[model samples]
Target: MSIKGKVAVVTGSAQGIGRGIALRLAQDGADICLVDMQIEKLQGVAEEIRKLGRKACAFQCDVTNRSQVFEAVDYAEKELGGFDIIVNNAGICITKPLEKISEEECERIFKINVFGVLWGIQAAAAKLKANKKKGKIISARSIAGHTAWAMLGMYSSTKFAVRGLTQAAAQELAPFGINVNSYCPGIVDTNMWTEIDHGCAPEKGVATGETWKASVAGIALGRAEKPEDVAAFVSYLAGPDSDYMTGQSVLIDGGIVYN
Candidate 1:
């Protein structure tokens, strides 16, 4: 599982799951390229990684902007000498029932969660192919991706698209020794979940904590998930041991979703 000399480009890495992944990879000896629209927080994460004795750089990237994503990837590869992994962890969600889902919301979710992933795969895969290097491309999917969730129609739809894209990329890139996969998480105790809890409260006529408690009840592990929990799984996917596993949406959901 050693990746001492590797470089990883992680999008949406200013906070939460993306930030955790970048720090974990850096702790594991990989140089990190942190990408996010929030340059201040992104640079903070880079500093944290640098403090861990790893080479790290922060790039201001809006994943929805294809050119920005490519430019960030190119800059990382150039600065780090090569790219070994790219984690497409930039995504968003809105709390709206099917009846309330709007075209604008649908388009925005797809742009970040789906199109963003595709753009990262295309950019990173091309770089690896041109260098004849085998690498890993990991993305963020969700439990809603596998099974539709009530009040999250648009988000679920976009994540489902992510699952398909990851698989297709895996199949196409296997010949070139590139691995593509995604981490599907559930009830992670992140800011995103906090937003979800608050957003669903009014709709469900419940207290804020009620929504979070109900979600945690379904997790057989009997606890909320952590960002580090997802990061540990991503670390595995980025390492040599997981080289044989590709095109798979591996769930790290504390048993909320079973395969």
Candidate 2:
């Protein structure tokens, strides 16, 4: 699919799945702007995009911060000419029982996962609306968004919120030919899983990457999902081919969630 003239802004793209998606979109011909909290790593990803022979820019944006996201979005619009696509890939996760979860932790998780998506949507809404032309807004809604997890409730809360956001935004944006939707990635084999595994493992007291691999053994697919796996789906969502799809959340899990 050729996204040749489309300008794409991807958040949390400094590494892992976000990085994969950003690069994949660039490869598909979209001019790419990478957003992340880590400047150095963001630069690294930008370098890689350049190597791919695509236009690239990196913005140090903490999506949870409204001003930062807005400024970055404006800057990107200025630098890239205009906004056409937005991939709200920035988010955070925290594993804790509802009762045991501290206020600070819960707030932090919601701020990043829930509010982050909202902020991105709000900032882009005007620009996307003004175009009244074809546009794409894709957010990262995880498999956890569709189901409950024993200790992942705090994190799951945000994914569910993203789902709601996608549905609502799609309904509102469709009039302008801008599609709004989300994609759920099931138990992706990103650094996130490693951290979750080690943190949850009581065997080694703290996982040393040795026992981490077994954390996802219960998955039906027998392996964790790859970053590219999710990226492929994201590419389709951001491409012209998926114009008919809106306000939907498609899972990229390896059968992790059959429903």
Q: Candidate 2, after superposition: displacement of residue 242 in Å?
A: 0.7
Superposition TM-score, candidate 1 onto the true structure: 0.98
TM-score of each: 0.98, 0.93
Task: Estimate, for each residue in 1-259, the C-alpha lDDT of model 1 and write its tens digit.
Answer: 5989899999999999999999999999999999999999998998999999999998998899998988988999889888989999998889888898778888888899999999999999988999999999999999999998998888899999998999899999999999999999988988898888998999999998898999899899899999999999999999999989999998899998888
Q: Which ten residues in a row have the lowest lDDT in candidate 2?
A: 203-212
lDDT to native, each model: 0.93, 0.84
Q: What is the lDDT of residue 146 in candidate 2?
A: 93
Q: Model 2 off-target regions past 4 Å?
A: 203-215
Residue 259, candidate 1: how far off, in angstroms? 1.6
> What local lDDT score does residue 70 receive in model 2, on the 0 to 100 scale?
79
Clashing pairs in 2: none
